[model samples]
Target chain A: MDFVQENSLAVFGPDGASNPIHVRDTIRKGLWTSHTSGLADGHVQGNVVILPEVLASDFLRFCQRNPKPCPVLAVSEPGQFTLPSLGKGIDIRSDVPLYRIWRHGEMSEEVADIASLWRSDLVTFVLGCSFSFESALIEAGIRLRHVEEGKNVAMFRTNVQTEPAGPFGGPMVVTMRPMPAADVIRAVQVTSRFPNVHGAPVHIGDPAFIGIADLAHPDYGDAVALMPGEIPVFWACGVTPQSAILNAQPAFCITHAPGCMLVTDLLNHQLASF
Target chain B: MDFVQENSLAVFGPDGASNPIHVRDTIRKGLWTSHTSGLADGHVQGNVVILPEVLASDFLRFCQRNPKPCPVLAVSEPGQFTLPSLGKGIDIRSDVPLYRIWRHGEMSEEVADIASLWRSDLVTFVLGCSFSFESALIEAGIRLRHVEEGKNVAMFRTNVQTEPAGPFGGPMVVTMRPMPAADVIRAVQVTSRFPNVHGAPVHIGDPAFIGIADLAHPDYGDAVALMPGEIPVFWACGVTPQSAILNAQPAFCITHAPGCMLVTDLLNHQLASF
Candidate 1:
């Protein structure tokens, strides 16, 4: 675990971690180089995707065709690092805790910042993540297994194909959560309010119906125990776009590192459609 | 099927059946004596329970404690047969299409009009029914199997117990609807908006978890087919309060017959909490 200096922590009080701007400032200064999971409670953290202007139009069309998996929260113009709509002084190059550099569908390196690699024709897309809805579920008294076990949510590449745009199209990716039967209904209601963050689940109950062969052997992330009376609920994941992008194999692209997201000024509750 | 006279139908146009006042007036004239399903399409229909003033307080408390199963829509004062709050000049004695007279738990007779049995001490209670939510679900494009087959919804007595008040205590009764995995999520969201009408489902997935052994053998109502790739979703039924009242064995009581209900002026969309 990465630790912040005691003197810096004193400036924002004990609950400074809950402040989105403060958390972004810490990342800007290179003091926080890890995942932004627990930091900035109640604020929206987005999945970052930066691609060249040439591929931006095609990728935007792909996201439009598949809004459930790749809901666009904000998009920055080519060569512009600032996303004014999401927050103040949001530098797409440095605000994200860590960045993954991709070369022709393959990740080549991970770095603290992409400032040196920034290009004049690069456009940044900020997509909604499931963290916001997970917070709402927890507040509604629904306990999530992955959060309890402190593990990455189990994600799977399903047989359901995404609507294609140019070279970006692949099987949809989904995050699974095991919950009690009663909580499953509440989870649906709670998550339905956040349409920008995948909204309600695409499929529930039977995993085989969605082409998932085994619960224990997930395509990505660590698998958690599915208790005796619990049923697995699935949501369209932000990782879906990453999968589509990788399949397209663009010459040069960048995305936030797994678990490391771009913290935004938007409140989680503000995303509720109701 | 009982048909309205052609002359009477002409007076209200082709959509006379969708008008609540016309439906009630037809019931008042003894022109319709069967179940009230499919009549007054966009209006709210309620499960009627009439008891002596001595038992009204206890029954009210039972509904308050177990709101999801017995959501109280309106309650009439002692000796009051009219429910002005529900509609104009709505008389409880003859508004329902059919009524069952219960004596010490066992129903003695089914009658179209209860004018002869009206007592000054009788108090009427109108509880929200699932018909309101079902209308909302269908409008959202989720196909219901029982509705498609034109059969009564399958109901069962679950091991799950309702909160007790006075002599009212018994196992909860649930209405089961088998829908495709995707519709199940939409059903949860659609029904959640109408908390007055059973709200969200109580249990989903395995029936044995809720103590039901066979889907083919329902305790009440007609059993519908559960197709492949579809999962059974359970919602608390309006029959729950009736079951509780039967277990209590009130010396004298009256309730709307199985499918017959009290049609009200309240529009179905008005019940949405959102």
Candidate 2:
């Protein structure tokens, strides 16, 4: 593990949820760089996607065409790093704990700060992440195996095709969480309350139905064992844009590193459509 | 056929849409005393429940607890006959084409107008109906077999229990529509967009899962056949509140008779949370 991972885990201990604003404030000043998974409770965490203005419109269309996998929370003005709408003074260039640099859709480097790389032509989009709804599920007493085991949630690339927009065309990527049949319905009802995040399960039951052959081997993230009577519930993942970005092969792009997120001041309840 | 069924069907052509405002206007002027099904096009239709202010608070809790089936669109002030929020000039006392008077939950009489029975302490609740989302499903090109065969959609009294509110507790009732598997997903997605009108589906596939023993037999409305390769889709029905009302056995309550509804000026689009 690197310093980013170590620092993230340090600030994400059991008692790290005192104040999300202060936690984020520390991260922006380079005092912290880590995964944001368990850092803040009840606040909205976002998957960051930064691209050149030239590719911004096409990416926006990609999100619109495939809303389930790419629900947009807030889009920042071109060349502007501050996302006051999502937080008081969230700096997109360095607020996220870690960022992955992509050159022509291929990840080139992972860094704690993007302030040096920030350019006048860059645009930032804060897309809704599963973390928002995961908190809701946990509060509803639905056990999340990944979180319990302290591992990244399991994700897979599915044969399920995404709606094409401009040059952004690729298969949808989904994350899996195992739950009993009865809890599945409750999970649907709870998650449906937060549409800004991935609303409801895109697919449930046998993974083969969605063209996923093996449960033990996930394309990304850590795989947890599925207990008896538990079925894998698949949801449209924020990682979907990564697949789209890879397919579109933009000249330059930046995204939050896996497990690292942009913690916004927006409350999870505020995102509920109801 | 009885006068209500004969008149309701007669008011609508084989393929024509019956406008809600026109139907309400006709009923308000004593021109009709029939069910309002098949009569609203692109308008919000509601299940009417009129109760005295004494029992209104408990009923409100019932609706809030069971939103899927009893989504409250608009609640009227005590003794008020007009719902300014739902329509341009909807008179709760007469906007419905027909109304049923229930004495202690038992059917007393069917009347064209409720003005004669109106009391100063009555409070009206307008609960959303499946018609709103059904229209959406059909518009999305999902074929509804019962509609094609010119029969009322099949509805069943399920063994699934609703969250009990003070004096208002009963089994859930669901409406069924059979469609291909692809359409079932589309139905979920489309209906999920309109939470105000019995949104999405409560149950799908095997009816036995939700404790419905037989598909060909339903407790309310006419039975429709399910063709091979078609799966039954169940939605939270407006009948749920009526069932609760019957369970509570509220004295001197009024509701729209089966197939009869209160049409409002609110457009269906206004109900889409997305």
Candidate 3:
């Protein structure tokens, strides 16, 4: 499938199908099986995690304890595949562009759809991603380097530990963006309004303070160059929850592949607390 | 006069006179004459710039062009000493605790009352100060070091130039606050709400980028200590306009002495843009 052509048709082409439902429809039909960034520009894209009913409550508690990294956008009922709250027809089994099957803290396989592997006791959780707040920052005229470079933001594992809940515990993960001093202040103001999507930065300047020693080498994603006048700004990343879930080592679990998120009907502006 | 005892009585003592009116009345009656920092805790304080009517419009234009530095809160009609717009009975001539009489770009005298110097051609311009935003930052649980040490905020003249209107143009002045990385982010958000009082920080990180050679020495105000892990955040200061006026060498001008301000009936929270 030509993912770029499908995204263009859904977002800005003659079809003008810019809504999330159309994006999800394309993903559901297996016509687009790639990263979901910039497909639904102003809509909220979420991180997906599926666990058995027995372990759902503990994960929910973990999300509550550390909300900055794992803001809960929607939770599906046991054995339910449709998320009525997020959209009209969001099928948890096949709406996502890609899914990863996990077994005992290890990734087993990457598949386009998870309908055949869906079980009766599975529950889905959608966590807020940084795409919404990043859109806000860009709209406010602060240029993000990763977006300009056409690469994923740099993510790092920090020594700062998250509050443990039951069997879920690990070091918090953070995303870094280097910006000039003036834009850094404006970025803080713009992102602070969207509390549901990892609002405001956790650490800025001197990555060593957050236990990340090197800016050139990140734990995940490609790192862009940091200019002389620019200082690195860090935010609590959605990857933190995924790392915790992996550490918990549930017998059978499923998650959306990195950068392949679930597009929801909720607008980015709708998540702003102010 | 015992300024400390008067401030205590007006703010926290048994007198229980914490209102702006009480503070103004004490100043008007010649009982208190000093900096009005901690008095009237939640009200707005203004920087005063009185000029002849011939130069008033140009000054207004200068303020409009460079709002971040000279945020005009209220302007008085020519020959009018009582500012009904700011408060019920704000006698501009005698309300402020201290006044500076300037002649030909030099300070001629320091007086407590300016009633004898009032002229029919004089126009009073009340510009917003940083006190309102500082109060908001402190209230939001961010510690300000200068406030804790009972010293003045550090001020420096930067290389950044202001938009010139007529003969009013000079190097922009900025106030510096050194804080940890987290508090720096919070301070940006807190101060961003008060647009009338220097909205957000103009610069952060390196002081040399803004043309300040030494952090230990400042052009105005007392220098506060910057800790090892702290970074300096800079905001556009009200002193920019005063410096411009002095450079223009206006024949007859008056201004409130440093740290002495005009207390208004408006509350600090009322100035929030959100």
**DockQ: which candidate is best?**
2
> Which has the greatest TM-score?
2
TM-score of 2: 0.54
Error of 3 at A43 (Å): 23
Interface RMSD of 3: 24.9
- TM-score, cand. 3: 0.51
* Residue-level lDDT for B254 in candidate 2: 92
Q: Candidate 1, residues B123-143: lDDT per residue as tens digits?
A: 888999989999999999999
Quote the lDDT for B179 in model 1: 94
What clash count does candidate 3 reach? 0
Q: lDDT per residue, candidate 2, A2-50, as tens digits?
A: 2253664454345565467777777877767777766667889999999
Encode model 2's per-residue lDDT on B18-112: one tens digit a residue: 66666677778866677665566788888899998777756765775577898877666668898876877788888887788999879999888
Pairs of colliding residues, candidate 1: none
Q: Candidate 1 has what TM-score? A: 0.51
Worst 10 contiguous positions by lDDT, candidate 3 chain A:
A1-10
State each model's TM-score restricted to chain B.
0.94, 0.93, 0.94
TM-score of chain A of each: 0.94, 0.93, 0.94
- Residue-level error in angstroms, candidate 1, position A183: 0.9
lDDT per residue (tens digit) for residues A1-274 in model 3? 1122224353333645477888898888887777887777799999999999777756765775576898777776668898876888889899998899999989999898898899998878899999999999989999999999977899999999997766888999999999999999998888877757998899889999989988899998887899999989999999999999999999999999888899999999998755
Fnat of candidate 1 is 0.00
